[model samples]
Structure formats: C-alpha cells, structure tokens
Target: MADPKGFMTTPRQDWPRRPVGERVRDWDEVYVPGALLPIISAQADRCMDCGVPFCHEACPLGNLIPEWNDLVSRDDWRAAAERLHATNNFPEFTGRLCPAPCEAGCVLAINQPAVTIKNVEVAIADRAWELGLAPPRPPDRLSGRTVAVVGSGPAGLAAAQQLTRAGHTVAVYEKDDRPGGLMRYGIPEFKMERRHLERRLDQMRAEGTRFRLSTAVGRDVGAAELRSRYDAVVIAAGATAWRELDVPGRELEGIWQAMEYLPLANRVCEGDLEESPLSAEGKHVVIVGGGDTGADCLGTAVRQRAASVTQLDIYGQPGADRDHEVEPWPTYPKIYRLSAAHEEADALGTAPSADADARLFAASTLHFTGDADGRVRELSLVEVDAGRREVPDSTRTLPADLVLLALGFSGPDRGDGLVDQLGLAMEPRGTIARDDGFATNVPGVFAAGDAARGASLIVWAIAEGRSVAAAVDRYLTGSSRLPAPIGPYDRPMVV
Candidate 1:
C-alpha cells in the first residue's frame, strides 16, 4: 500500500488545462502535454486504498484502482499500466473523456476531494507507451474461427482486439470512411487529439485485426451473408437515432443534428475540408441541450468565430455541491459540472448574462422564426419548472443564425437496415435486446455497447465489448479462458 498517512499529507490536485484564450484559437487539446508527470505520484498518493474500494464497483471495467494507485504512487509506471489494462482496453480514451464515477465512489470523497484517479490512469498509460511497453503480442496459434464485428467505436474495437488476441480472425466493418465510429467524428479535437486514436489503431493492425472502412454491414454487405461467412458476429453499432424536437420551424435551413454539425468540424480536423459546411462563422449560435454534447457544440462554435453562443437546458441547473441527501456517498451525483468546454465558453462569452454563465437552465424552446428566405433568424423560448409546467409570461426571443439540436440519441439507427436485415429483437426503450451472455435473438449473433444499452459513456462501451468477446470465445470453442467483465444488463454506480 502507499503511505498510510499520504492522504492527509497531500491535497488533491489535477492537471492544469491550457489557457482558454489560447486554446480556443486552435484545435489542440486543452491540457498541457507532459505537464502532470512530475506531480502525478503525489496525486496518486492521495488514494485511501479503502477496504471495500467502492471505486472498483463504480467503474464499469472494474479496474483495480487501488492496485494501480499504489503502483503510481511508488513511481511504477509500467506496473500501473499493466493493472489498468488488465480490465480496460483503452485507458487513454476513458481517462480523457469519462466523467470519472470512480472518484465519486472514493471513500476519501466523504470528507475531502477524491484522488485524481483519471489523471493517474492517463499518466501511467501514456508513460508506458513512451517507454515502448504497448507492442503487439500476437497469439501463438490460430483458433481456425472468424469473427465479424460491426461498428468501429470503442466497443467494437475492444471486442476485435480481444478476439484477435484470443487467436480468432476478426474483421471490423464501419459505415463511415474511417474505422472509428463516434470517436473519429463525434468528439471535438479540442477535447482529445486524434493522434491518440491513430496510434491505437496502428497497434490493433499490428496484431492482425482487419478493418473494412466505408463498408456498411447491412447495406454494402448483407447481414445474412456476413453471418454465413464468419463463424460469429458481434454488433456494436451504437445508438445513433438522434432524439428530435418536433416543434415548429424545425425544418429551417440553419437547423441541424448534433451528429450532423459535429462531424463537419471533425472533417476539418481530418484535413478533408478547410472549413465545415455549417460553420458558425459570424453567426449567433443557439445550442439546445445542457449535456456534454451541447458543451462540445458551444466550444466548436466559439472556435469557429461565432458572433455569440448560448446553451439551453430543459432542466434546472444542478447544485454546485453534491446532493448527498438525494444521492449519498459512493453514488454518482448529479452536480453542476463545468466541463473544460464550458470554461472555454465562459472566456469567449460576448454577452453578460445575469448569472454570468453562457448556460440558460430551466429553459424550453417554443419555436423557431425564419427569415423571408426561409433561413432561421431567431427562436422563441420560455421558462419552466421542474415538473415542466410553463411559467406565466416568461416567453422570450433570441437571435439565432444557427440552431444545433444536441438533444442526445434515441436508439440505434433503424434507417441503415441493420435491424431489418438481421431481424434483431429490440426493446421498447429503443435498444437491441440481448440475453445474459450478450447474445441476441438470432443464433450466432450478439450485441453490445450503446446498441444494447441506451446512450452511455465510453467506459461502458469498452466494458460491454470486452465482456461480449469472452462469451463469443466460449461459444466458439465450447470453453475459454477469457474474462467476462460485465453482464448484458450490468450498470455500475449509476445514480
């Protein structure tokens, strides 16, 4: 264990992000590169290493947080990476993107700020990579079986890598031009650089996981035909059916889906486009939704030199501090989260609101008003209570040259014909149905990730992928040694 008194000796500290004024001018990540390595050991020492270690139960990947924390605190970067990778396939992505529910489960959080587990995880993984610890360890022999993985997000990639290491042939099919489904396009570069993703892809390729890009499993290649070709199939196609607001003027030219607008900016990062077709340049942008996706749009708009930007949320803002009365210790609380994007948005704000933040909480959109040329010029909104009952005489209008619907996803993309082709059973909650082993209704077919669950974080996606691969391995050989990380219906530390 680390120093028993270390928690009391060291205060919780995090990596310093780049200045808002400087980061908004470029697509680089907000964090300072290699700036946390020296102090990360002190931060890791802050872990209490409790007897229960609720942090493990809180993580979907069931990461050995205490073990790795101890290793990091002792300056054992290679061993820390080993303990982290034992459960998680991609620590780099999760360390940067996940909300860190493990911190909420930390016993130290009961009194003081939680240990910077995410930072320690990233520091270990990145240091191991720098020291050439992440090399391809190809399987000694072949299993003589082939697996087809649909979608190339975190889940599909995790499944593919695990299956390949298990000595089975794996081919990942992606609808988009690139292999990464959402990670390639949905996420903004300001949050995470694309190089991290590219390096991992290269490692997977070195281990013999083939990628079939721009190949839709249901459209370009028939799902039925694919099932016959491969011994087994894992459908990790994420929930992409965007939830929409059907209010009036939704069909205006300036309106777009979050998926639609986010990818355009990503294309610019890919050098495929000099500028996004729907760039918010010189426009007043209004982003609907208060989640991380909405914050991403706000940051992207500010980077695109928008005249002004505002984020609207249907629910009232959460408390600044955790509500222990409603969600007590070890539970992921719904506190007001000011993401890095929100901080950047604050520095870039042009108008001064009453609350001094760009966010408009407890707000509801009524309708949009377009110009004579049928382009959206403004939108109408009103205030509402927690019950969604409208407040009297609260109607207001704001100029909006561009309107982005970041209202989140409803379910899997049904229009792509994957469901119709496979005849997969779907739950009423708009997710693909699967058994305890992650197997679908169809024999020899399985589902995982957001396709089987609702829209969730990347940690859950990678966990589901790793779990489903073990099931497929058992199905193929009638017995296997791979570890199952989660059940089809398992959720961790969800408040």
Candidate 2:
C-alpha cells in the first residue's frame, strides 16, 4: 500500500509545464522534459491504496492503479510497467491524451489532490521502452483463422494486436495514406507527437499485425469479398463525418470544417505538405465550438501565426472548480478547463475578443458576411436561449477572415459503402448497432470502438477493441482465454 502515511507526509505534485510563451513558439510537448520523473516516485508514494480502489471502477480499461502506484513508489519500474501493460494496451497514448477519470475517482481526491497516476503511467511506459522490456509477443502458431480489421485507430490497433497474439492472422485496412487513423492526421503535433503512435505501430507490426493503408474496404475492395476472404471481420472505422452548420453563406471560401483544417496542419507536421491550405497565418480566425477539437484548432492557428483567434460555445461557461451538487466526486466534472492550448493562447494575449477570445456563450451563428471575392469577411451571430434557439433582436457581427466550424462528428464515414453493402443496422443516432458481443446482424462480422460505440475517448476505444477481440476469439474457437475488458453496450461510470 505504498507508504502507510505517505499520503499524509507527501503532498500531491503534478508534471510541470514549460513556460507557455516558450512552448507556443515550438512544436514540442507542453510539459518540461524530464521534469516529472524526479518527483514521480515520491508522488506515487502518496497513494493511500484504498481497499475498494474506485480508480479501477473509474478507468474503462480497469487498470490496476494502486498496485502500480506501490510498485512505482518502491522504484520497481520494470514491474510497474508490466502491471500497467497487463490491462492497458497503450498507456502511453492514454497517459497523454485521456482526461484521467481515474484521478477524479481517486479516494485521495475526496479530500486532497489525487495521485499523479497519469504521469506515473507514462513514466513507467517510457522506462519500459528504455529498458527494452516491451517486446513483440507474436503467436506461437497460426490458428488457421483470418480477420479483417477496418480502421487503424487505437481501438482497431488494440483489437488487431490481441487477435494476432491469439493466433489469428489480422489484416488492418485504413483509408488514410498511413495508419493511426485520427491519431495520425486529426490530432495536432503539439498535443502529442507522432513518435508515440509510430512506436506502437512498430510493435504491432512485429507482432504480425499486417496493415494496408490507403485502402478503403467498401470502396477498393467489395464488402462481400472481404467477408469471404477472412474468417471474421472487425469494423473499427471511427466517426469521421463532421457535423456542419446549415446557415446562410455556409459555403463561403474562407469557412471550413474543423476536420478539414486540422488534418492539413498535421500533414504539414509530417512533411508531406510544405503549406496547409487552411493555414491561419495573418488571418482573424474564429472557431465555433468549445470542445477539445476547438482548443486544438486554437493552438494550431496560434502556431500558424493567426493575427487573432476566438472560440465560441453555445453552452454557458462552466465553473472553474468541480460542481459537487451537479457532478459529484468519482464522476467526471463539467468544470472549466484551461488546456495547454488555452494556456498558450492566453500567453500570446490573443485572448478571446470582447464578446470574450470572442466567445458568445448562448450564441448561434446567423450567417456569413463575405467580400466580393467570395471570401468570408465577418460572422453574423444571434443570442440563443437555453435551448439554443435564436432570440429575436439580439443580432451582432464580428470580424472573421477565417471561420472554422469546430462542431463535433455525426458518425463514421459512410462513403466507403461497407455499412450498406454488408446490410449492417445503424442506431437512430447514426452509430452502428452491435449486440453485447459487438457482433453485427451479419454473422462473423463484429464491430468495435468508434465504429460500434460512436465518437469517444481513446481509452474507451482501446477497451472496446480488446473486448471485441475476446468476443471474436470466442466466436471462432467456441471457448477462449482472452480477457473481455468491457462489453459493447457498457459505458463508463461517468459517460
């Protein structure tokens, strides 16, 4: 249980970040390198190791947080890494990207700051890489079974790795030029560098997971042919259909979707493109969403030297601290968060404009005012009621050279024709429907991750992948030894 009184003796300390000004000018991660390792062990020592371990309940992967906290506190890094890998397939990714619901569910958080679980998890993973502890564990023998996995995102990758190790020949198909799906193209470089994604791909390849990039299953290859070629098929195609705002002048030249803008920046980072078509350089950018994607756009535009940046949200601003009455502890809180991008934006004094970084909470876009050249010049907005309905006589206009619709996704891309060709059923929400085993109406064809569960966190996606792999293994072999970390219909306690 770590140190019996460690919680009392050592106060919680988190990873330190570089000065916002310095980090904004570069593409490196926001945190200071090597800054957390020195204090992480002591921070791990502060874990109380509660009897129930609500953190396990909090994590979708059901990670053994207390055990590893004790292992790390004792400086048993190799063992800690092993324990971490026992449940989570990509702690490195989640350690960086996940919102850390486990920390919110920590017993220590009931009174004080939670243990630095996310930082310690990343440290253990990094140490494992340094010590050569992580190695490919390819199957000893092929099972005479082949599985076609569509999508190379975290969920698809996790399922592929698990199925490969379980002695199945798994082929992953992606429409992008490279694997990693949204991880490769949608995510900005400053938040999480590509090296982390590449290393995992290397490990997956060594474990015999074959990848076929730039191949859309339903388009390049017929869905029937895929079903006939493989013993089973797993659909992990993530939600990529960006939601659009249908208003006047929606097709203006300078107006774009967040997905359209973000990937171009990522492509530039990959050296595939010298310049992005949606570059915000010297432009007045206004993002019309308040989620992580919008923050990402804010950061990327700042890096691109946008003359000014503003973000708008339909909902009112959340409180700075947790709202215990509305959202209790051990559940994810709907509090205001200052992400690294927000910090960087604030540091540049490119603060949201008077309408605040020009946010008009409870506001809705009315139309786009454009110049004669067909370029967007300004945005017309109207005050909205709690229901997001436009209120009368509350119109306003704001300068916006470039307007990015940061609205969230609607569902997976249907352009591939797989859903229709395979006769798969979709929920009313546009998400693919799957049973408890993640199996579609078509037999032997399973679904996982965003494809099955809709847009969600990377941790949930990976967990769903692992679970679906177990189900697929069971379907193939009648009985299996693989772990079922989650069910298709199961949602996190918070979600």
What are the lDDT figures for the candidates, one per model? 0.90, 0.88
Question: Model 2, range 1-495, lDDT digits (tens) per residue?
Answer: 768899999988888899977887877888999898899999999889789998998898999999999999999988898999999888889999898989989999887888888998898888888888888889999999999999999999999999999999999999899999888888898878999899889999999999998899899999989999999999999988888899998888999999899999999989999999889999998889888889889999999999988887888777777888778888988777778887777667674453444345777788998899999999988888878888899898878999999898868889889999999999888888988888999999999998778789999998998999999999999988888888888777753
The CA lDDT at 474 in model 1 is: 95
lDDT of 1 by residue, 46-84 (tens): 888788999988888999999999999898888888888
True lDDT of residue 448, candidate 1: 91
Residue 478's lDDT in candidate 2? 94
* Predicted structure 1, TM vs. truth: 0.98
TM-score of 2: 0.97
Q: Which residue ranges in model 2 land beyond 4 Å of their true spot?
A: 352-360, 389-394
Give the best candidate by lDDT: 1
